[model samples]
Target: MKLRCELLLACGLFLALVLIFWSEALPEDRTLFLRDLSAEIIPVRSFWVRSGGFALWNPYSFFGMPYSANPQNQAFYPFNLFYYFFGAERGLVFYIIFHHFLFVFTLYWALREMGFQREGSFLGAIGFSFGGFFCSLSMLVAVLSTLIWFPLIIIFLIRAGKSHWLKPGLGIGLLIALQVFAGEMEIAGISWLLSLFAILFLPEDIRGHLSVRRIFLALGLGIFFGAILSAFQWLITLEFIPLSNRASGFGLVDALLWSIEPFQLKSFVIPNYILPASRLSLSTSAFWGLGFFSEYSYFLSLYSGIIVLLLALFSMGGVRSWKIWFWVLLAGFALAMSMGNTLPVYKFFYFHIPFFNLFRFPSKFLFLFYFALMMLAVYGWQRIQHKPRRIFGFGVLIIGIGLLLYLIFSRLNLEDSSLGAELIAHKFFLRSSLRVLAFFCLGLGLIFLLGSNMRFWLSAGLGVLCFLDLFFAHRYLNPVIKRDFYRGNSYVQEFNNQKRSLVYPPRIASLSAPSEELSFQWLTDPIELYSRLRDGLENYWSTYFGIADLRAYSLFCLSEVSELGKLLAEDSLSPGVRRLALARSGVEYIYYRDYGFVNLSLSYPRALILYQAKIVKDREQIFRIFSDANFPGLRSVLIEAEDKVAGDKNFAPMSDFARVISYENEKVVIDAEARADGWLLLLDSYYPGWRAFVDGKEVRIYRANGFFRAVKIPAGRHRVIFNYFPESFTRGLLISGIGFFLWLFLFGISFKMGKGRK
Candidate 1:
């Protein structure tokens, strides 16, 4: 009977949530991430076209792309690639659903791991799913996806708490790896939270259970493994990985703005409200500064503020374990609340610290506060062991109802009241069922507190509530929210409304065309480009943030024009540091896109179209047209070769340096210098694999480091030759050595520790 009841409630809640998401269109404001993910995957598609290689991709694309070189491109930072490559149609919808499932499962597992009753786990999941963070991020697919990892990390930490050093070390390592795949900002924030929790939560005896030395060793091995494994591909792609970017963090005032909660809730039944005339926004014009608030009216700062306050109260007056959580939540809340202010503590922590440049958007730490609050709520409910006297219970319920009614009818203006009333019908049955359910829960809790005899009933009732909250009505809401909120702002709508000119790094397209101004006028107006631009940078900004560019009106939004122009010029430069500027007058080729908001629209082809637009009639013949914006037309190719050894007797003069072994299908090899220290042999090809040897001795060199490759010989010179293949063997051996040693070290110590314990 108990099992059946549990199943019915869980099923009901799950169904409701699914319905809400399905009915609602994907939310628009946060939907940029889905679009961005789609944009980043274009290169992978291009890779398939060029090499037919479908291996798991890192952040870098091998085809002379910037993502391969720039650290900011961070792997999976472009998430939608997997969606579009695997599921061309409805890929985003499917991905969002998958995230919803992950959120539910992870929440369930995390609560269970924390030793909550089955029902407690269920309610905890429900509360978190509907928490302000998820609700706001649901509209943002990439951020939501990244956020899901937090629960799994908590689960691992709980499980690890019971184990020896190695197990926990490995668990923490895996969590770190997952965060890295999500990108650096996420990894940093999550790592900080975990470290803070570890210091606060883990008992000293348990930590001492494994000697500090062994624990440190295990942690070291885990970090070493994690670093190499997660970054190996990145290391190989760019030849090295960097720790920081030149651009990171906000000014004190800017960060403070992020810290302030823009929304607050006065009463639960009514929607949350924003204070337009508050300190954060002294006037309507001041509030409109960012264009974010002006463009979107659905900011939920009020709701967030209310939920946080309730959570704070719920967390107070708890046992040892609960108190730890309370303090952690308080710390997070304080940090979030200080985002825009210039407190000495925040300034010292964020600005004065050396590596603080690694993090941006300190305000996003609110995610930690949100999670803490959800867990505290669960703990509070678990602690509620007494029932009010019958008269008191009825009176309290009446008071709650009365307060809700008064707020709904009197405090709220007509428009707000009408809005709340409309939602009243939408949730009337579910809310009614919950009220009745709450009474039952209260009775059982009171019974449990009074006598141990009713323990089973308490557990049973808790389980039932869990089912009702998580698995039933929530699932049904999915469809409704998806239709109403998610789908309403199609990329087309955004495209039609924006008036920003974009400044993209120079590609073959940009070089072949002149400037963005001509490109926007001919190919896409500002409004149309707006939606496409959001899609392009969606995944990019999940970890890497910048303000939107508004170059179309000869205006700037979040970017500095001179700096951007410099970056463009640098990218368009040759290895020799010479600038290669594209035609600037006129061009007469038109590349039309049927899908105005597709990935192809954001690809190099669109940039090229605008580039070609800058060309005049004279340069028209130099450029052709590409239907897919991602596949830009090749305008002109430049080739230059030089033999560095001119004066030395490194075999011959520049003309006498002949191609030794040439393969049309792959690459060409040349026999040249067999000299020493300064004797350089340059075998330049577009494809990979070129190695040089001197007198049967292999000379190893790092490709794309300080130099591509250099061979040393006696000043007089001997025999020198270069071989061309796909990859160099030296890099492969080094990678193998690192992996093998790391594995052996971790396992060896773990085995020794096990023996010692035994």
Candidate 2:
């Protein structure tokens, strides 16, 4: 009953902190409304709309990307069934809240064996929950969701030492499946590996009670069955991994792309080194000299809290034993691994490890590093209350050290003079920095008032300190978004109405810039990140208006297509560049709207629709024509003697006067009236999944016009149809269904056999 009360009160406090931390989020104000939202969330939202039907292909993004193959979108995760009902914006908030709860719950459950008091348990849970990784990267829903399952599985692994097969085995398998289903495969993979490590390296005390052979058998089944349970998502990802854009493979340098930089190690002392400008307080400018964008420049802070750090360090101060050394080694390993190419150790792992070769972004391991710090904090607070000198002396030292950082960073010159206002308003950062350190100092100062028996205030003060620090960190950690960020141009409304009146395969393509949302690009540096989805969101808007789009932000940008985009970025490029990019994308009608918020313009691509296709020379000559400034426009498209060029105001150019019969994701029907045996070109992306049929007979679909689908039609008005039937998705689904039931059967048989023996 006491434990339950403590949990309820702790939950209330945690939720309040959540509300305060995310106070900026409001209706229609998308939280983290850029990269993660656009690339991962919105695309999944778009996928959800068509997935109920047989749409394995997304004809909107990047001239039609493979919807099912893009594993990051995470549409297939089970949590979506409940959360998605709230809509994307609200669903994200709910997900963040729910995962925070899970984080606390799992940590508390795992700590039960150590026999910490109620207050100690509560503090450990909150401290771990409020760690810098959680505060900074909570916006990444998949990572947050995937992370909570680690502790939960650890709790189950702790139970794995028991001789009974059902409890530990069922818990491990179910929790592992949940983690895998949470949609961050890389993180989930690490969690499973860690769980296996724990299972194999059972504590000596617990190992004594268990039969080694039985334990091994049960643990093996647990892992194997867990894989089967998540076979649905796993099988599809396995198929996608080799062919993904990363399939070109990651070189050592590429693996270090998001590695924690050497300078960023200062984040251990100075948090918020990578916060977005919007999250900065006015005082941040005074300390601005210390700031730098090493990599993504967001979601990398791992300073749990100053007081928390003091307590964690003190917890290990009294020990020089195996337990402490074990943590030191593990913590050092995580940090070194996060260093990527900066350390030779990571390079060795990249080449020697199988999954390590797949993805980059090494700094993501900070979450694990932060967990290690929390373990020390739990032990420190548990022991430090009895040691008064350590608390008082450590508190004073933290307070005094603020002057050193201030002196070092305050003298630096400004790169951007405009940022000086922040320093001026906040008294050149002196007042704010002292106040931040003072928060920790005050929590520490409260320690002197503690007597030997009054442990409650000491615990309560520390718990409140953790919350205060997290509130301070994340208040700016989360960017405040507004309606203006997403709400743009009346063009979407006009295009929405235009889409209803358009012919079959009503796919829209931008003729000039990738999107009208390019205005947001100027905020990011020579390279854009943490907000690359500005263009992706624009494409999502087109999909929201129920129109298929040609330009979409995709990770799987084909090399040829990526080069085309780069060529178009230069103002010196000809109008032919736009024509070539759009022509191959099956764009019949172009939407060209540009608002002069900046000098940026994407108002040219759609205008190419007016340039009728004419026969030109071969592929080599086409590139030559594009290079020449004096060369002609869309006329360059006519390459071969057999090449046919035709499209109308409505954009469907199946042959010449191709009337639309019907258009669906599964199939498209067109009535063509071609003169002689001219080829009928469908300006949709070419994928092996699509099959072509003419007048009810199967015909071959050829990759034509660089990246589009084209079919040869005999002269007549016979109907031509194209349908999507991706073999990979179908095969994966069948295997997953069989595997799921097979897991059920095996688990039931084992469970019954164990009961009979009992």
C-alpha TM-scores of all predictions: 0.54, 0.78
Model 1 scores worst on lDDT over the 10 consecutive residues at 606-615
Global fold similarity of model 1 (TM-score): 0.54
The candidate that wins on TM-score is 2
Give the Å error, residue 678, model 1: 22
lDDT of each: 0.38, 0.58
lDDT, residue 388, candidate 1? 34
Question: Which tens-of-lDDT digit does each residue in 58-150 have in candidate 1?
Answer: 212111222222322333334445444543224455556666666676676666555555655665676566544455554444356556666
For candidate 2, write residues 241-269 as lDDT tens digits.
55455666677777677777787675565
Query: Per-residue error at 696 for model 1, in Å?
Result: 19
